[model samples]
Target: MNKSTTIWGHLSAAPHRSLFLAGSFQALLTILWWSIELAGRAGLVAPPLLSGITPTWVHGFLMVYTFFPFFILGFLFTTFPNWMNGEKIRPNRYMAVCLLMVCGVILFYAGLFAGKLLISAGLLLMLTGWANAIAALFHVLLTAPAGDKRHAWVAGTAFVAGWLGLCAYALWVLTDNTDMLNFSRQAGIWFFMLPILLTVSHRMIPFFSSRVLENYVVIRPFGLLWLMVGCAVAHGILHLLDLQGYAWWADLLLAGCALYLSYVWQFFRSFHVRLLAVLHISFAWLGIAMLSFGLQGMLFWLNGGEHYWLGLAPLHMLVVGYFASMVLGMASRVTLGHGGFPLKLDHLTWLLFIAFQVVIVLRVIPDILPFAASMAPKFYLAAGGVWLSCFLLWVIKYAPIYWRARVDGKAG
Candidate 1:
């Protein structure tokens, strides 16, 4: 068997290739499915169909658990070894993870048509994949150097939390338990995705900026890090305990910290380079999202649950603005750097990234325009449509690099 030229060989050659490729496709597919469902529900198409789980729950599950993990795991697998001077993750280990997860997601889509049993089985498989990733990361943590393993430790714990959230989701699929569903959704956002993304941003964004922007001082304060983490976890715990109203303090503090870092990280200077600009722009949304969350919560509390302005606005901002934008920026950088291309984006991709900002606006418009209740679904369709299109184009631009050898003749 010629291992060098085979598709399998190329895919499994590096940890990021197959996983990132799969993630890009998953990102496209999930949104496409959502857009279809939205159109159908809005009566722009045929009647909508429901699988074993309700569409709302299904959307939450896929967005939180399925879509982002592939990219997250791919990035970590490539960086963890370097981060800790630990051993590179074995191809077999990450391969097992990728295969299991890809198959599990396919099964989930299929399960939508088949039955609840198939859906349950799919969830179990995904949980197993999550377990595999967690174990691999845990190994890195165990062997990492003693100096400042805090990011590693925090990111590792977030992965573990995500796995637990997947467990909760699996239980929800199996038993139709709302509590499990709620736990999975809330924990996936706060305990799982937030910590990891924040740590990566805190660790990398400044580092990335300093490398490109002259006179950029990289100030990574551990005190600020812990404070952000504290506020995030506190807010998460408060929401989980159904004391969401009291979370205003934590959310406001988080917003302030995020904005402070954005400024100190030289958000203004980033526009000098498109690649760095994208990362800065994405991080900018975190402050906006948190500010929205805190202000909305404060209003709700102050008005005695009577004035929740901008319902769902903050979440859409986080997911589309912060999460997806970072994914695009980070993944673009990874694909270019790892694939032996120049570290800059072209005009077309830059425009696509701008389009993503439009997507955030479209999504949040509906939330803020709750007065236009009749038009909300139309706005949902528009947001979903734009999101699907952007990712589709993005996948087209980047996915091929994963399967082909490096352009510069360097091995991955």
Candidate 2:
């Protein structure tokens, strides 16, 4: 019996399909909700404030927790088996994760209009789903036959850290402890998402580039990878300890390593293929973001820790510029390759990606230009609008492929 005939059947047909499909919907929903909130803040309209919750805290929580894990777990679930040549993850396993997470997100939205109790309850559900995801991936890691498990191990360890971070968030919701919330944000980004994203990019980018360009030398420095990961953790720890001014060396060193990789990757050489080009471009943002962080920290230190420069621009570059763009590019490449379509970035998708770059710029502008500080809310609203537009357009272009039968007559 072919399961591809029905919508539900097609969704569960593959690990990536169900997870990515749900993630795509989430990608739209999270940003749309945030954008509306931003509009209200900018005096565009009046939306009801969250109950017993600071909007910024909730915003950080939603972005950190509800959003990227869908794509991250989906990518890991789809790739882990092949990476280890191990047992395949069962449908029920991923479906359980998807259903729990989706329901949890819905409850979270309901909680926004309700109270802290609902919000805390919603996070508990999400935490459970997240734990299930980590366990499922760990099982794959643990059961794999004797082989190279560096990537799997690193990623799996990061998932555990992420799970703990989610727990912190839940605890924060319950106790109103800002320290827990802060730890959650730092752990979620630096310890968890950063490591996983870099690991994936490190593993995949050079391979993809090597295939397309003749005589391309793959330059993956594992030592550098370890160093960058260390610096990332150190930066987070410094912030946790309120020693941010001392993190200049780590941030700068990381910036150097990342920028060196970009130069070696040969950005201009891959533009002939838009798909490969996007990945390269996305990877380049890491260097740029870190450079911003390094310079900001350096400037802060030089001025006796008096004035902070660039404000949130560096962080935005990391979040949207590198993380979001990398997810978009990699997800698109995977979708096309797996769905039996030509592995090319079409003009519409390409334009949407370009527009996303504009979003990053808009987001960073208010922080950089001193005069624009007063208009930060308006700029943020515009940035949110552009960001939503990008995802909305791109999701519309690709979401159907998740559930549709592959056009190449291949099973998922």
Candidate 3:
């Protein structure tokens, strides 16, 4: 494949191709909306683009639901079938879903520029695409010849819950209900995003550890998974009711659980391999997030819940530290492996991964540094630039690989 290679030709050939397209689209959105947000926050832009929801909410919605789900679905669509010993997805089906999602993204942005009708339509299309993708995976689970279906089912359930949350958010847009928005956001976080991440990480990290480290213990017990899910459900419920003052309990429990799981999963031992270290360290951020949430809850409870929780700082920790890092590492591995390249993390990629951590830390400065209030805008913009740079680097490195057939001359 050369410059003449059509995106349609590539997209219709494999699930990863479509997924890479979707991810690249979302990355572009991230750069665009983030710049708009930073400019507005820094008072570099006037007549703020506040419509049905705030700009911050818009950014969150795009990142959490739009940007990440494409990557998640891409990974799951490819791997879940293999896990269940089912057939690979047909190209036509996945291509249609990808097209629908792309259109939805376009319409959603257009709605942001125009009116609510377009926004509602866009969200509906997005939700439809999401539902279709999840349903396809569920079908694989249903039809698989034979395999351990437990983890796949759990992950699928979380995706369904996430769809429900997205539905609620769309409802908020249609009806202008702030409460619905809040509920959707909370549900999406605890029920949808975190559960999927935790469940997948639980299943994969230990398995990866066992493979990478000789005699490594695979520590995923059903009980532990259940406990983690239970804690997440409780956290979501507390958030839904706006009773985050009591969230410290759930947060602390989850933190403890995360710590124990990390220990049993041999996080420290995985450091010998940089790629595995990336996964292990990314999971470590789950612990950090829970601990931060617990602390924030305690502070808020002591101060009577008067907006003293550092403004979604803990959530950002999980988003950037865990989700983004894992995505980066996993994407790197998948791209290289599938593209007929060695699954090795070269020095430059490792340095970029470290830079990603720096980006995450920079993003948190405004939340943690009260004295740095005057410099918060600079920090925010700088973080966005850094974040954009990371994705841009990924795109530059992998876009060609994604566009071409596998170097081994394989079909898919």
Candidate 4:
């Protein structure tokens, strides 16, 4: 092999130590949160630490900003080298940023549990960590030698913006500024949530679906999707400005987007793969989320309507159904493929996937039924149990693969 080929191979073959560390932290956090919830249910604490804004906010923020970013960095490190035709990009800075973020997460959570001084200190640390991570990512993106890699650039930028927004929001919360907090949340979602989801969904959905449907055609143009995103951002801004009277118009824009994305679905159905089917199914939830939010906005226009819990429904659906499902599916695929295992999933894996879907259903369906709110926590617990089990199974099944180099002596 030529030197270039050898370098590419080495870059690809490098151990994903960071990815594993981050994944482990994510899994541990998930398990810990659930355990706290379960304890609350058993009436152990006065009011469980898991019951309030601090826990929920910290959990959500860390999951998005802390846990997943590591995986993102690891993935980019592995894939970008190959994408750039074997150019090496050392990840020492990225790893350092990750470590800083982890420390920030711990400090932030501790402050929430402690009091105001801790909260202030934690926020400062978090901001510093996030800024470093974002800077490191930007440097990597600029130096990576890939031309017009729009998706990578978009995802990376969204992540940075999202974390920055989070930092601002944290400060607002510290100051007891409700308006700023609300605005920050809306800004953060647009800056972070939609972009990251679109980037990942676009890359993975078609690719994974194509695995089952040999003839699957993955559509590439996302101009229309970006337009929808613009509308969503506008809606967020209007709501923040208390001009939510115009929110209905924004919803109309999303409704139109739902229609367009539906066509994308029809195109996918033409290929017909079960693996692909799951992706389409998740996207369907996204479309449904858009429509639901639109409908809620319309209701608000019709009357002095309240912000319904139903909004949580679609958000959870996107997070758990679309984002989590995609992550689980891709991680499973990559772990198996890189481990020199067969592409085919075994019975256990299939069952785990099904269980994940069941969890989504249980978590989502209750929103349509208010009386069922009492039972929602139970379903969440059950879902959490199943999710934890799946991850454990994954660790058991793929630990060897992750630990040992590829059996074929080929680079990952």
The prediction achieving the highest lDDT against the true structure is 1
Clashing residue pairs found in predicted model 1: none
Q: Of models 2 and 3, which has the larger lDDT? A: 2
Worst 10 residues of 2 by lDDT: 1-10
For model 4, residues 1-412, the per-residue Cα lDDT tens digits are 7766654344345435445555655765765675575657656545455212555655566556555555555555555545445445554555555566667667666665666666666667667766775665566567767576667677777777777677666767577676656756675665676666666666666566655665556665678667666676787778777887667676667657656664754645623444445456666666666677777677766776665647477667656776666566656666666667767667776677667777677777678678877777676667677677777776676655554557777755
lDDT of 1 by residue, 9-82 (tens): 77888999999988998998888888888888877788556675688778878898889999999999998888
1 against 3, candidate with superior TM-score: 1
State the lDDT at 39 in candidate 2: 80
Q: Which model is ahead, 3 or 4, in terms of TM-score?
A: 3
Predict model 4's lDDT versus the native: 0.63
Q: Clash totals for all models, in order?
A: 0, 0, 0, 0
* TM, every model: 0.97, 0.97, 0.94, 0.80
Worst 10 residues of 4 by lDDT: 7-16
Ranking under TM-score, best-scoring first?
A: 1, 2, 3, 4
Deviation (Å) of 303 in candidate 2: 2.4
lDDT of 3 by residue, 217-275 (tens): 67788887888888888998987776778989888888999988888888778878887
CA lDDT scores, all candidates in order? 0.88, 0.87, 0.82, 0.63
Question: Rank order by lDDT, top first?
Answer: 1, 2, 3, 4
Q: Which residue pairs does candidate 2 place in steric collision? A: none
Of 2 and 3, the candidate ranking higher by TM-score: 2
Q: What's the CA error at residue 298 for candidate 1, in Å?
A: 0.5
State the weakest 10-residue window (summed lDDT) of model 3.
1-10
Q: Model 4, which residues run further than 4 Å from truth?
A: 1-17, 34-46, 49-53, 80-87, 115-129, 144-146, 207-212, 248-252, 255-278, 307-311, 399-401
Return the TM-score for candidate 4, rounded to 2 decimals.
Answer: 0.80
